[model samples]
Target chain A: MPGQRQSQPLLALRGVSKRFSAVQALVDIELEIRAGEVVALVGDNAAGKSTLVKVISGVGPPDKGVIEWQGAPVQIRRPQDARLLGIATVYQDLAMCENLDVVANLFLGREIHRFGVLDEVEMERRTRELLHTLSIRIPDVRMPLAGLSGGQRQVVAIIRSFLGSPRLLLLDEPTASLGIQQTNQLLDLIEELRDQGLGVLLISHNMSDIKAVADRVAVLRLGRNNGLFDVNTTSQEQIISSITGAADHAVAHRPHPEEVWP
Target chain B: MTNPLPTKARVAEYAGGVRRRVREGGLGPAPVLLALAVTWVVFQSLNDKFLSPRNLSVLSVDIVGTGMVAVGIVFVLLIGEIDLSVGSLAGLAGAVFAALHVNVGMTEWLAVVVAVVCGTAIGALHGFLFAKFGVPAFVVTLAGLLTWSGLMIYLLGPDSSISFSEDGLVASLTSRYYSAPGFTYGLAALCTAAYLLVSLRDRARRAGAGMPCRARSGIWVRTGLLAAVAFTTVAVLGHFEGLPLALLIFLGFIVASDLLLRRTPYGRQVLALGGGVEAARRAGVDVTRVRVSVFMIAGTLAAVGGLFVASRFTSASQVSGSGMLLINAVAAAVIGGTSLFGGRGSTWSALLGVLIIQSIASGMALLGVETAVQFMITGGVLITAVIFDSLARRTAASRVRT
Candidate 1:
C-alpha cells in the first residue's frame, strides 16, 4: 500500500523570474509539486527561497514565466488569489490572531459560521479533527494559542493550512522554533500529509529535516535553479554548494553557543 | 495503538486539555488585579474612603462624563492610534445640540439627533483625513481636538452658556434610572445568562472540534463567581439606589464595542492592523478602511459621552469640556488593560479601567482631598497604568515564549 497514491502534478512553474528594486530574487526557475509528495525547497539565507515561495503563494506575481496548476497556466495576484488557487502559506509571523483563542485563531478572517455568529462548534470540531489527523497533541482546543508551546503552535499553523482544504500547504520553516520532540511530531505530520494525497512545498534550513522528510530537494544557488534531485540520490554537500555559491559559503557562522542558544 | 474513544470521552478529553491555554489570556482577576494592584493598594492607603460605596457611587457618576470620552478613545488606541480632539468633539456636540434646540427651534429629540449626526459627519471627515491619507491618527485627532473645540466656541457665539432641563427624553435616557426594587437582581440575571451562553457555546465548539478545554468545574465556578460578584455589587448598590441611567449608557457602549471588536471580521481587521500594519496588509486586511472606521467610532463615542455630561450637568457652559480629554480616556483604557502598543487590548479594559480610576477619584473626594491633590493623584495613576500595561505585556510575551 506504500506509494499507492497516484501522482498528478499539483503545481508547475517554468522559467519564472522576479526582480526587486535592487536585486533579482529568482531566475530561470523551474519547479513542480505533485499530488501526494512533499517537496523541500532548500537554500541558504537570501537564496531566493522566500521570493520563490511568495511567487508560488501568490503574495507577489512573478515578473516573468508561466505557472501551471493541473497542467493549465494561471496567474496568482494576491493572497486571496493564492487561497482561491489552493495555496496556503504559513508565514513566520503565522498570520494568526494571538488575542483570540485557538478556535478563534483557526477561523479568524475566514471564520466558520453558524447563523452568522462565529460557528464555534463547527470551527472547533474541524480544528480538532485536523489536529488529530496530524497527530498533534494539543492539551485543549479552547486554550488560546498564546498558551501553546512553540511546537503546538506550529501544529495549529499547519492544520490551519488544510482548513479550507487546500491542495497544497506551503510551510515556511515550520519547525524553526520547535524542540527535538516537536520537530519529530511535525515531521510525522508532514509525511502524513504526503501520504494523504496532499502536496507540500516545505521550506527549511535544517539539513536533517530536509534529509528525513523531503522526498525531493529543489536547490537554488544565487537566484538560479541549480539542481533538483531525489533526497536519496543527492548529497547534502552538493545541495549546499548549489544553494549558496562558493564565494558566499552556505555553512552558517552561528553565534557562539555561549552567546546564542542560551 | 491509539485508543479510539467514545464520543463523550472525546469531548471530555478535548475540553480538559485547553484549560491551560484559556488561563493564559488573563481573562481572570489575577492578571487584572496584578495589572491594577499597585495603584489600588497605593490609592486605598492614600485614602481609606477609596473603598466606600457612597463615595464610589459619587465618583462613578462624576467620572461617567469624562470616562465615556475615554472609552471611545480606547478604540482608536487599540488600532495603535490616538484621538486628541475627543474633548473638543464632545464640546462641539454639546454646543450643536444646545444651539439647535435654542436657536434653530428644533425639537429636543430632533436637536439631539442633528447634533449626533453632525458630530459623526465631522468625525467621518476626520477619519478620511487619517485613514485615507496615512496621516498619523495622533496628528489628525490632535488637530481635531483643537479645531473641534474652537468650532464649539464659534458655535456658542459668545453666549458663554446655555441651560437645559433634565426631564427631556434625552435627559431621561442619560439621567434617569430604573431604581426599581430587585432591579439589580434582574440585571444580574441578564449578565449571568449572557456570559454563560457565550462561554458555553465557545467551550462546546472547541470540545466538538477536538481542540483544548478548560477545567469544567473551574469554568462554571469562575463564571459563576464573576456573575455573583457583579450581581452582589449591583444588588448592594441597588439597595442604596438603582443603577444610574448613565451606567446603562456605558453598558450599551461596552456591549456594542465588544461585539464590534470580537464578533465581526471587520473588528478583527482593526486589531490586526493595530498589531502590525505591514503584516495585516500582507495578510490581505483592508488597512486603510480599518484605521478610518476606528477613528469614527471613537468620535461617535465622544459625542455620546458629551451628551451624557450635558444631561448630568443640566447646562452647556463656556468651560463645558475643559480638562476632560487625553488623560482620563487613556487612563480608563490602560487601567482596564488595553495596551498603548496597539494590537493587544479590549473594550472590557475601558470599562474596568474607568471603574478603577473613578473609584480612586471618588474615594479621594470623600476623604476631602483637595482638587489639586486629586489631579496629582490621577496623574500618578495614569503613569502607573502605563507601567502595568508594559509589564503585563512583557510577562505575557515571556510566558508565550515558553
Candidate 2:
C-alpha cells in the first residue's frame, strides 16, 4: 500500500511566513504530512507553532507561503475555504458554546433542517450514533456542554471536526486538559484516525503524547524549523534539544558541579 | 437509549430533571411567575377593583404597546446585546405614521407600512455600524436614541403632536375586540387544541427517532395548564370589553417569535452567536448577517409597538416613546428572565415581564399612588431582577468550572 501511494503529500507547507505588524510570527517554515501519518509538532513558547496551524486552518492566512494540498497549490483565505478543502481544525480553546447542548454544538453551523426548521430529532439520533461509534459515553447528549468534563468537551470538539469527514485533521493540544485515562483514550482515538488513512497534525508540549501516537516529530524553535525526526528512530532528548535549540549549546553538554563533587 | 420506560419511571425522571435544572440555576420561569402571583395578591389586597375585569382588560391593552417593544429587546438580549434606540425608534415610527396619515393625507395602512419600513431601515443601519464597522452596540444604539428622538420631534413640527381621526385602521387596533362569547371562547379553544396537537406530534416524531420523549402524562398536564390559563383570560376579558385586538396581536407576535427563536435555523444561529461570537464564527455562522437581522427585527417590532402606543391614545405626541417607555421595555425583558448577558432567554419572557410591569403600574394607579413613588418602586424591582440574574449567572459559571 505504501509503494502504491501517490507521490504527493496530503498537505505541504513550503517556505510559509507570517508577520503580525512589527512582529514576524513565522519565518520560512517548511512542513509536510502524508496520508495515514501522525505528525506531532513540538515547540517552545513563541515558536510559531500556533501561527503555523492558524495559517493552515485558514483562521489567519499566511503572509507568504505555498500550501500544496493533494499535490496542487491552493489558497485558503478564510475558514470556509479551508472547510471546503476538507481541512478541519480543533483549536486549543475548543471554540465551543458552553450554553448549548452537545447535539446543538455538534451540528451548530451545519444543522439539518426541513422546511427551514431545525430537524432536531434527526440531529440527536445521528449524534447518539456518532458518540456510540466513538465509544464516548455521556449521560445525556442533550445536556449543556458546561455540564461536561474537560475531557468530554475535548472529545466532543474532536467529534465535531469529524462531521465533515475531512482529509486532514488539525488538533491543537487535544489532551492538554485531559486526565491520565482520558489522555490515553485520546491517544487511542488519534491512532484510530491514522489507521483510517487520515493525515493528522498533532500539536502538543507533552513528549509522552508525541511518542505514543506520532510517527514523526517536527520541532520548531524561534519561528524556524530546527529538526524533524522519525519517532521510532529518535530519542525524546533529541526532540527536546531540537525544540529548545540547545543541541549545540555548551550548557546542554556541561556536567553538573554536584555530580563532580559526589 | 430508545427503549421506552415505564410511566412511573418516566414521571420520576421528569421530576428529577426539573429539580436538577432549578438547582443548577436554570430557574426557567418560576421566580417571575411567583413575583407575578405576589404582585397580584398584594395589589388585590390594597384595592377591591385591582383585579376587576374592566381593569384587567385595560391592563391588557396597556401592555401591548411596551410589550411589543420588549419582545424585540428579548431578541437583542438573547445575543447578549442591547438596543437602546428601540424606545426612540418607537416614537419616530408613530410620528412618521401620524404625519403621513393626518398631514400628508396618505392611506392609514400605507402610512403604517412606511413607518415600519423606516424602523427596519434604521435598525439595519445600527446593525451595519455595529457588525461591519465594529462599533459597540451600546454606543451605536445610544446615538440612535438621540438621533431618532430628534428626528421624531422634528417630524412632529411646531405643534409637537398629531391626532389622526378615530375609526381609521390604526385607531381601531386598540378599540376593536371579539366581544361575542362564542368568538372569544372559540379562539381560546383553538389555541389550546393547536398547542396540544403540536406537542403530541413532536413527541411522536421524537419517539419514532428513538430519542427521549416527554412522558404522555406530562404532556396532558402541560396542555391542561395552558387550557386553564387560556379559558380564564378570555372569560375575564368577556366580562369587560371582551378580548382586545391589541392583546391578540401581542400574543400572536410572542408565539411566533418564540417559534422563530427556538425552532428555526436562523434563530439557532442568533442563539449560537449570543453564546460565543468566536465559536459561532468558527462554526461557519454568518455573524454579521445574524446580528444585523436581529437589530432589524428589534427596529421593526419597536415601530409596531409605537403604533400600538399611538393607537391607545389615538394620537402621536412627543411623549409617545419617551420617559419610562424605554426603561420599561428593557426592564420587562430582563425581568421576564431573559439574561442581559444573552444566549439564555426566550421570547415569552417579554409577555410575562410586560404583564408584571403593567400589573404593578395598573395596581398603583388604582390605589392612586404617586408617580414618583411608582418610579422608585419600579426602579427597585428592576434592580432586584438584575441581582437575581447576576447571581444565577455566577452560579452557572461556578457549576461549569466544577
DockQ (Cα-based) for each candidate: 0.28, 0.54
Best by TM-score: 2
Model 1, retained fraction of real contacts?
0.39
- What Cα-based lDDT does every candidate model obtain? 0.73, 0.88
Using alpha carbons, what is the TM-score of model 2? 0.95
The candidate that achieves the highest lDDT relative to the unseen native structure: 2
List, residue by residue over B241-312, the lDDT tens digit for candidate 2: 899999999999999999999898899999998789999988888899999999999999999999999998
lDDT of 1: 0.73
lDDT of 1 by residue, A1-262 (tens): 2443354478999999999998988887999998888899976667788888889877778999999998899888777778888787787667665555667666655866555555656666677666656666777677655566776677677677777888898988888778898788778878877888788988888888889988999877667776787999988777775665542332333332221111
lDDT of 2 at A186: 80
Docking class of 2: medium
The TM-score of predicted model 1 comes to: 0.82
